[model samples]
Every structure is written in structure tokens, then in C-alpha cells.
Target chain A: MTSDAVSAGGDPRRLLADTRTFARRVRVAQRVTWLPLLVLGVVTFGAILVQAVSRPVTTGCRTTDAGEICKVWNPVLESYWLVAMVAAYVVIAGGYLRVARARGLGSRVRPYVIAGVAAAVLMFTLIAAGAGRWIVPDPHDLLNPSTSILVLFRLLTASGGIGLALLVLAWLERNVALLLFALGYLAVVLVPINFGWGSHWSGKSEGAAQLIVNGLVLLLAGAGFALAQRLRASR
Target chain B: MTGPVDTPAPESHPVTGLDDVVHQRVRLGILTIAHEARRVEFGFLRTELGLTGGNLSQHLAVLETAGLVGIEKGYEGKRGRTWISLTTAGDAALAAEIARLKQLIARVETTVPRQGEAS
Candidate 1:
């Protein structure tokens, strides 16, 4: 382990210089893992766009005492979107844990596990609550054929995003850029839903909105990555 | 003419109070990396530090013996892997080293005259 720097009685200057070198190395190491995940996100997002544009819409009907309720269902879009989301979550979680581990911060995994479990429990609890009619009278609103999956997707996004953000913030308390990335990604996922722009093939404006949101998300992510690299390089 | 004038030897420079175990380049690298990560894989440490398998294991053993790092061996998809992480004591030690380094830098800045000032 002895080197010219180390053998120099651990001089503060040497230590600082060495630290910077090590940090740069760590950042380079992390980029190897992060790049692939970024690629995966882009590919998944592209697939969702493709499915949204081409999939045929089917109508789903349900009989009730008052009348029959009907709604358009884009199964292709829904299924593909759900798969993409799940894949994203898996990739994000796995990549995060791997990178954290590589950097020697394995203790941070606890929060991730806790967040995941909490999210799953929340999802089931919502489902059960809706089933029991304890909340909304219409279970369909909470877990209907059209909205249930979307709700689940949103819940997963919130849980995963918030959890990862909290963990990263706790680890790198000074890195506000990470927090921005997390919040930005969360907003990118939730904004359209909040505005009632369902993730289905509707029209040109919908597609345009999706593209804009995705672009913003990628920008935020890229910024966060760049900031991390810069921070590591500087110190 | 005088043959030579006395000058301070480079070897006479002041020493830092950094821990001997933590001072080694490879060990310092390990600690720094571990401090950033929650738990690091043995393979990652080896790759990042550019150490051979045997060499990294030796250093990890030394850190583990010093109680500065913890090592866990487990199986990952039929392959055995080792995970290394800093203990609480290790974290404190690394923080102290960094603090000392910062102080040393500051002290040097205040006491040492630059070329322009010396002129």
C-alpha cells in the first residue's frame, strides 16, 4: 500500500491530492453503471411512446343498478407502460444499490428496502381499503379497469423516487443537485397525471406533452450526473 | 569564500498526526471509497484501485484487523463475493484524517509566504 504520497508521512497536501484522485476514480467507476441505466430508461420511454401511438383502444363496460358504465381501455399502452415502469424501478434500485456498494456505502440500502416495503404495503392497503368501501364508494375510481394500474404506477413512482431521494440526501447531505434530480423526475412522472393527461394514445398534443416531459426529465438527470462529476472532480 | 551555507533538509519537515494504518495509499483509497458507499463489493475495490485479487484481499484483511472495516462473504447467483464496508470507528477515523488535512492546508496557507510576497 506504500506509495510516494503515502510514504511522505501522510502529508495533508498529499492526502488532499490523493483524495481528489480517488474521488475522480469513484466517479468514473459510477459512470460505467449509470450510463447503462440511462440508456435503459431512454429505450423504455421510447417503447411507451411507440405503443401509445399505435395501439387500438377497446371499450370496457360494467353493469350497475343505475346504468352501465363504459370507458375506453388501451390495454397495449397500459400493459407496456406498466412493464416499462416496473423495469425502470428494478433497474434504478439495482443500479443505485450497486453504485452505492461500489463506493463503500452499503449501509444506505436499508432505506431503500424500507421504502420498497412501505410502498408495497401502501398499494395493498389502498386496494383493500377500496375493496372494503371504507374510502370511496366506487372502488372503480381507486382500482377500476382503467385507473387502477395507472394509480399503482404512480404510487410506485412516488415511493421509489422519494425513497431514493431521501437515501441519497442522507448519504450526500451537501449534494442538492441529487435532490433536484429526484424531485424533477417525480414531477415528470406525476405532472401529466395531475393534469388529467392519461398515458394513452389520444392526439398530437398528448404526444408532444409526453415528449416535453421526458425531455425535461432527461435534462434534470443529465444535469445531476454532470454536477456529481464536477463536484467529484473539484474536491 | 564560504564553501556552503546551511539549509533545512527536506527530511526535517513536520509530520502529520494521521493514523499509520490509514496513511497508506491503498488503504486510504479503500477507506475513502468505503466512506462514500454503504457497502462495497470486493470486486469493485479491486477494479477501482487497480489491485490484483490477492493484493486487495491482503489490504482488506489489514483494515479488518484494525477494526476500521468490516468484511462479509456471501454468494451472489452461484458466485461467492465479498463485501467491504467501513465501521463507525472507521468513519470517524477517516473524518478526523480529512479534518486534519484541512487544518494542515489552512495552516500552511497562513504561515508560508508565496514568491510574490517574499520578493
Candidate 2:
């Protein structure tokens, strides 16, 4: 029978057209949602690399049971690195909010963005404060502080970092794998510090740890970009 | 020319198997967009579908009344915005509509003869 004889059936062409339109719309939306986070990840990796290279190292003093002791390098640069990393995070959060607004993601996302920014700021301030104490010591004691405050700040910093990471991850749903990689990176960094494992590292071991962590970060960033490219190409 | 060519009856055809509300072009577009996102903005839908504010609102109202979509109004910064999302019922309806469309396509493929065969 001629196809025209089946006129009572809906047009197959029309259904196909609708399906194509839906698919196209979804593809466009996914691209818009993910592109920003991907760019931010690359930029963050670059900033970290620059900070690592430019970081200044100098001999410093520590207070031990015997007397005032000298250490090979003061971690002053680490503070600066933390500041730069936090700044990058703030920028990413701000950019995400702008993109969401532009795409009409509604006002509901505003609170999450605000919370993310606040967490970034809190993390930065705590790290900077700890670094300041190291660089400019109090007259009575150069190395030690109230142990309670030290532990409190460390906990706060970890919480803030996790909070910001989660907010960014939620906004960048398309790059979920990358975001999880980032969270894993954070966990690797924070878990050791939380347990005070760094205190046991000798000077040489400290350097080795730093190198290993930095290498892992580079690997994660590189893998993230590659996966993002594969996803885009497939799309 | 051949006395209406004996068009297939409605009961015998698969077109009647489709849902009227979900099959509409604009409504279908709305459902498709909402399904992709956690929650979609009213402005986004209007821009994507190329519908006026009032036109989109009417369609949204119909969907809302039918328990297919939920509309939320809230403020972002200082400005008011409306968010649109598909209800559970809406998601199910959309899925069913898509399945029905696929079945129809398959039926057409099996029943319609190729051009070379006709010759």
C-alpha cells in the first residue's frame, strides 16, 4: 500500500523533527554549563605552577626543647600559594554565578554561589594568618602557639575548602569526573595535614612530599583536560 | 482520486495512541528542556522556544494545572525570576510519549514499502 494510505497515522517526519530539536537543545545547554569549569581548571593549574616556581625559600628558626633551632626553609611561599589558589577559586565561583545568571538558571543558585565565596574567603584568611605567625614570630616563643587554636584553624580550613569544592562541583555537573578528581586532590592534601603527618617529615622528605603532591596535581589536571576534550569531541 | 484511498481508521492507527498534551510541539519542547536541567528558568524556556512571555506563561499554566510542571517564583540578587521544572507525572508522561513515538516510527518502517519496490 502507498504510504499515503496510512494518513491516519501521525507524521513520522514530525516526530523525528521534535526529537532532533530536543537533542540539539540539550547539547547546547551542556556545552554552556561545562565550558566555564573546564577553563577555570586549566587556569588554576597554571597559577599553581607559577606559584611553585616563583616561591621563595629561606632559612628560618624554630623553638625546640633544647633551644632555638634553625630550619632550612621557611614555608612562607606556601602561604602565598594558598592565597593565590583561594583567589583562583573565588574567581571560578564568581564566573559560575555570572554564567548561571546569564543562562537564566534562576535565583535559587545565588545562595550556593554566595556560600562558596564565603568558604573560599574563610580558607584564605586562616591560611594567611597561620603563615603570618610563622614569618613574624612572637617575642616569647617563635615556633609554638596555643595548640588548640592551631587545630581549630586547621579544621576550619579543611571544612571551608570542602564546602567550596562541593558548590563548584554542583554547578559544573557536566564535568563531574573532573570535579571528583579535584575533590580527591583536596583530600590527599588535607588528610595528611589533619593527621599531623607533615611534622614527621625530614627536610629531604618534605621536599619529596612536595614534589610528589605537585606531580599528582599535574597528572590530575592533564587527565581532566584530556577527558574533557574526548567528551567534547564525542558530542 | 481513488475515493479517499481508504485512510486507516483511528482505532487501527497508532497516532491515536499518543497523548495530545505531550505531543504538542511547544509543550514537547518545554518538556525536553526541563528534563535536561535540574530546574529551568522561565526566561530560558521563553528564549529557547522563541515564545513571548505571555505565550509561554499560558502554556506553563496549562501544564501546571495538569500536574505536569511546577512553577516557582523567587528573587535572584534583587530581581525576581521564575523557575520551571517537570513534575514526576510530567517526566513519566514525557517518557511515555517518546516511547510511543519510537513505536510509531518502527511501525511505519515495517509497513511502508521502499521506493524501488513500488516501481
What TM-score results for chain B in every one of the models? 0.81, 0.85
- Tens-digit lDDT track for model 2 on A169-230? 54545445555665665555444333345558654444334334534453556555557656
Query: What is the number of residue pairs that collide in model 1?
Result: 10
For residue A182, model 1's alpha carbon misses the true position, in angstroms, by 9.5
DockQ of each: 0.26, 0.14
Tell me the fnat of candidate 1: 0.52
Worst 10 residues of 2 chain A by lDDT: A1-10
Q: What is the lDDT of residue A177 in candidate 1?
A: 51
Interface quality of candidate 1 as DockQ: 0.26
